[model samples]
Target: MHIFDYSFLDNGLLPAALTNLTANIYALRSASGLRREANPKIFTELEQVARVQSVKSSNAIEGIITSDERIAAIVNQSSAPLNHDEAEIAGYRDALNTIHTNFKDLDFRQADILSLHAQLLAFSGNDDGGKYKQNDNLILEIDSAGKRRIRFRPVPAQETAEAMEQLELAYMEARGNANINQLLLIPCVILDFLCIHPFRDGNGRMSRLLSLLLLYKKGFLAGKYISFEEQINLYQQLYYTALQESSRGWHENTSDYAPFMKNFLSMLYMCYKELDKRFAILHGKKVTKKARIEATLENSLTPLSKRDICAILPDVSPTTVEAVLGAMVKAGKIRRVGQGRATRYIRT
Candidate 1:
């Protein structure tokens, strides 16, 4: 059996990948700065929508079952569903808001990440929130015939804590080394933590939040403007397949994280690429009123009516605003609220 070794980091493709990634990231940062100035409002609206979607998908993956209707209601009506699940969805929103507000200044410890997990599961009435699993855990596979099967199981409970501690130590060591690429280290840490399966529930959601926090620490603030969760949600089957591939033979003590790592890198690159496209559009000289409105809604605190939006830009004609709103509403990018004079508009 080929036992996977952490020391493989000394020989893996990580260094070459990190160097290339760093260069790309630097270029991306420059492009993003230019976009921020060129179309500030659109960028802001995109960020807001991204943040909300990220939180929603992250929670949903853990079986929280947040519906599109519930999310739409939250945004449009400030009204929440009366059901228990809806309450949990509301908690997710609250947690996401807290994370966003403090992400700029916060640095997380292992305990902090665990606590976030607890908060994430609290809405689902899972009491193990913020606590590590005390018993042995297993990943199970169920076939179409509904046969019970064990996929992967962690080490004995006696060794679980020590294993987790070692993982955390590795994470901290990499985090403190300025020479190490934070992006590479973050996914590694997340992979290892998931392998550990420390918490009884909400492990998946917590791992994602940890990923965001790590990215934020590395100055990947653009993630807050876009979601890894949204990407994962769309490719959920692929996501699970990658995780399974990485963990295959883990019970036999094999180390093969290549598939998982590759998937993660691909997702990250996709986000970076998308942001690049948006930046390009922003910097282009032929910006339309529709584009400007999109950016403004992305950044706006309160959804605005056409008149309210026009109030902000005295230079833009009301006819232009009306035209842009009509086009956007047609495009399904913005939803109109109320009728006639009492109407308002918000990003959809």
Candidate 2:
């Protein structure tokens, strides 16, 4: 087997999914134009919201949860951890803050990775933070019956360091070549890292943290305004399925990376799209009764049903809302999604 090789990049072509994803990325990138196009105050507010949601969702995915109010307090540091879960949340907040503040200076090397892990679990009583697995770790899925089955076998503890080195070397070598897209390059490395299961714990959180870092480095600033971790947590099952599918046969270097890549790219696209919608509402845009219905739709990060829009604009008549929605749809400013009562409209 050709371990740690990036022979997959040789084709100089992308698969259909990636090709489509690349096109979407290009369109959104062009739409974004310059960062200055967004209001500074709006961006700052959204960034803070993203931070709180990201830390909360990432921890919640691992079944570590606290009340939304508590999460906010812990994240804002207005309060201390009331329990173990809150303490963990606090640790994540610190690590995420560090990454946000210093990602440009952080290298994607073993030392840095370990350090990030250490910071992630710093408040926890576990002394094993920052250390690689001293024993084999099993990837498992527990059913409702509490039954656990091994999902995949990671690199044994003895080979953990070397495997990590090889994985990073492969990514760095490929990254140096401009022919490969950083978008594709980053996810492949993440898939490999997850499959390797290099750390004893916090692999999932690390993957998400590294995702933010890699995206920022590649100039994908969507995560700064929208919480990608929250998206993944919302679609948690899809995330796990993509990882499981992409990781199959990984040890023999024969795994397909597309599933996870698709999920990653799609989440990124959603983030940007959300950012666009949310941006329209910010920057002191005044709404009138005439534009209230349309503005309400534009203001939401997620698609809104007629009832949803009406609830936000209780003063507006349903007839008026319907008329404006029809005009907007026909004018191509927004389109209908879903069906009937489930129908929602979103800006095109």
Using all chains and alpha carbons, the TM-scores for the candidates as numbered come to 0.73, 0.83
For candidate 1, write residues 1-348 as lDDT tens digits. 222235445444564665576567667766776766777786776676676667667767767665554664653337955677666666556556656777776555666666566666665666776777878888787999999898777665666667666776766766676665566666667777777787766667777777777777776766666667877876788988989888877656675766777677667766676666544544442667566656655544334666545644434688988888888889898788777665878778
Which tens-of-lDDT digit does each residue in 165-242 have in candidate 2? 888788789889877777877788888888888888899999999888887877787887778898898788898999
- Which candidate comes out best when scored by TM-score? 2
Residue 280, model 2, lDDT: 62
CA lDDT of every candidate: 0.67, 0.81
Clashing pairs in 2: none
Deviating ranges (above 4 Å) for candidate 1 = 1-7, 10-26, 37-40, 73-77, 155-159, 249-253, 280-348
Off by over 4 Å in 2: 33-38, 144-146, 288-348
